[model samples]
Target: MSNIAYLGIFGPGPNSSAAIVSDNEIIAWAEEERFNRIKTSPNAYPAQSIAFCVKEARKLGLEVTSIGYAWDCNSYSELATANLEQTIAKYPSETDHISRLAQQGLNALYNPTKVKQDLGLILRKLGIELTDQNFKFYSHHLSHVASAIYTSGFDEAVVIVNDGVGEVASSSLVYVDKQGTMKELATEELPNTLGGFYATITEFLGFKAYVDEGKTMGLAAYGAPDADIMAVFDEMVQTDGKSFHYTVDPRFRYSGKRTFGSRFTDLMVEKLGPSRPADVSAMIAPYPAIAYAAQKKLEEVLFAQMKYAASLNLSKNICFAGGVHMNCKANGLLAESDLYENYFFQPAASDNGVCLGAAFLAKIDETGEIPKLPSLEHLYYGPSFTDDEIENVLKQCKLEYVKSDNIGRDVAQHIAKNDIVGWFQGRMEVGARALGGRSILANPLNPDARDHVNRHVKNREAWRPFCPSLKKESFQGYFDTVIDKSPFMIVATRIHKEFLDVLPSCIHVDGTVRPQTVNKDINPLYWSVMNEFEKITGQSIIVNTSFNVQGEPIVMRPEEAIRCFYGSGIDVLAIGSFLVKKGRR
Candidate 1:
């Protein structure tokens, strides 16, 4: 009998994606939003994304035999149905007409049979017949653990998954042995969720809850963490040696609601002073202090949990996953503290990458043995274009582009002259952070480059810091702490005192920099441009930001890249081997 192939799907929320795998390899993986031009969460099922994965598998002449859903709807059947009923019961008397209708919609969304019907429809669109035996469901948190620990290449490690409510758990701690067996040590269930708490604070601080947490993180640098504010959080969220608990404040508790209720904002005002207004210019005095306090309290509680996990597992290696790990500053603090000898956070740590986790776990169940999977060295796992695809888009737009045999050197030359370059190369990346594939490259040496990109090109909050793409070899020279291996842009580290002014564009106000170290082997073309930039200037760092503007998804095609180049203040566009100047056509 031949080994079974698995197709993984993540849907019913944003970051809908699909992953296809044979017995031996991950044939392809992609987020539906990448193709559909949506941001993190999409409401529909991953039909288009599954189609892409199926097409990729067909191209490789592999047949998919099993389908995996990252979320276990059955696991949440009782709890979810109960929660929906409670909401509906309270709706008529306590809720308005609009609120009552919304709860009615939630009733249908949480129905287990509705989930199966949606899955069937999604499978049919992908040309796969849905069958009970052919499909398997994995717990959401377990899928996250599998994604991190399996790809970590660690023989044994402790795994931690932290995100918004998944089924009933908000945080989970498990131990994976040398043979890849997972043992659930403990879990902190809903209403006590760290992710939900952080998101509430995020919304209170005048930003989109799930989406703008990064902005609040950046703003933390400007204020001091107030003891009073920290005490408030400490009172609400408690951590023991082995397990953690949250004493829910009815004003601000996680009920698995899509949006935080008004009581959440009211509590923030009562505890931390008035919440920050949404008007960007109104960002003033106490807001930064509140952000600082929230961030510090979060780190304190989270690190305690990590320490408990470390004590129980007795492993030097740790595999961290979920949206919380996206806090690069906190990750940097952990890396600097020497808690773990090795730390692994997958490139797509959020819900988007759980598709890979589901597929890997399904593969293990089918074979009854852990396959020898290769460590992930690169994240170029999405769609790629051919030379003809590139030229055809250019021709369709009637734009003149010059094909270059040496695009790396030419693009480097433009950057050296302080020109902003839109770089689109190879396959699109599968995460929030843009690596080399879809990025905006600028000279880190330019004193004005950070403001130029933030204000002119990205039109984002000016205080938000830009990241540096540094040559891996130069890691020792630039940073105080010798963290030579951060490829995912998920870890923040301190900049050397001497190099702070030198790389001002990439350094945050707090003197920390989130750097993605580049190597020649993983991304040769991107590395070539960095090499040439370093040759021109003594610095081996370049300001690397995502290719998209503040509110848009990253550019997915050559035509989108071209449109962005012309729309923004960018001077040059480099897609494949072709180069187009903003006004040269």
Candidate 2:
């Protein structure tokens, strides 16, 4: 039989994305935000991403045999309707507005028919036909689980998924046996969600709910946990102290009319004080304290849930995915714990990653047997440009540039001279991180590097930390952690006390660093640059932030990288092997 290819789409939500898997290997993966230049690409159909995946499939002479969507909307409808009815019964006064919002959400999110129609139209535009028989939808939480466990290269592992509501379930504990059969051990359903709680707290602290939760996680490091705030959180969500199950107070989340807003009701404001205004500084005392308390509570509750998962005694390995797993601090806590002998945290532990899972499920459904595959080595599965393409863009922009005989050494020299370089290399990375493919590089030893990049390059909050991309050999020397490798920069760990002052720009206030440990075999070009930097500075690390400014997706094309280079304070643009420099010292 010929090889089978499956196309997966994750969309009509934030971070809409698409991916293609063929013969048990991922061919292409990309987010719609990168193509549309919208941050997170909320509720946007992933047409451009689908186009990319199709093009990549064609290049490999593979036809898409099936299409899989990341959500099973039909599974969510009844529970959603019942929840809405309960909410209306509880708050009769706000019934009208609540119903209106519910209807809007249904039309936008929970309508599978609309998604099918949109996919058909998009496929038709791409010279492909979509049929009901060839397309299937998988459960959202199950997709999250598969994204981690399937790519983990483990025959048997326990999977934990935590996110905002997915078909009524917010959290799930699942066990995958040696035969690749998955058993649902337990689940925490909607109205009692770790994700919703975190998002509500994020929004309450003057940040966007889904988009800025990372900001809250970062801000938490600056404040001491407040007992009063912790007490308030205890009232909102409580565990049984023996199981993975938990309960949420309906008044705080998605239940009824609020004194403040839809995310939180009068009960929350009455207990936690008024929500912070968007214009006010997030660095304010109470805000940080609130963030700290929220982070601590999240970790405490999550640890309890995982401890229960371990007690089930199913497997020695554990895998994690979902939007909530993107919290590196919480992931760091879990990494340090002795709950599981081996752990695999999905790099793209968000809705976008569901495409990978959906594709894998489709493959299993089509082939009748699970394909044994190697663990994911890297995420460089998106678009790439040749040297000719970079040169053409440079010539069109009328910019002076040069092809470097040794790109790594040249870039290293610029970085050592304290120049901020926009480094756009081979295929873009699939996840949220820059990962050397599309990165802005700076010298981490430069004390002013972090502030400069935050202010002039990224145009974001000064308190936000920049990640360090270091050689794999350098990981153990700098960070004190059990994680053997962190290629995705998704887990934060404490830096050694001796090296804390050495990497001033890379170390966060908490003395922890989210590092991308670069293996030479996976990315030789990036490793070569770090190697060259080590030769010059005697440290095998460099500051690596995504190649985008505030409120924009990471640069995808050569033109976008050029635009960003000229628009930002970056002093140099390294596209492929060619270099373009702004007139600077």
Q: Return the top candidate by TM-score.
A: 2
Which digits, one per residue and each the tens of the lDDT, describe model 1 over residues 26-50?
7788887777777764686777778
Segments in model 1 whose C-alpha atoms lie over 4 Å from true places: 1-4, 81-107, 240-250, 253-265, 280-282
Candidate 2 lDDT (Cα, whole model)?
0.88
The ten-residue window of minimal lDDT in model 1 covers 254-263
The candidate maximizing lDDT is 2
Give the 10-residue window scoring lowest on summed lDDT in candidate 2: 87-96
What is the RMSD of candidate 1? 3.1
Write out the backbone clash pairs for model 2. none
Candidate 2 lDDT, 409-495, residue by residue in tens: 999999999999999999999888899999999999999999999999999999999999999988899888988988899999999
Cα lDDT for residue 32, candidate 2: 97
- Evaluated at residue 468, the lDDT of candidate 1 is 88
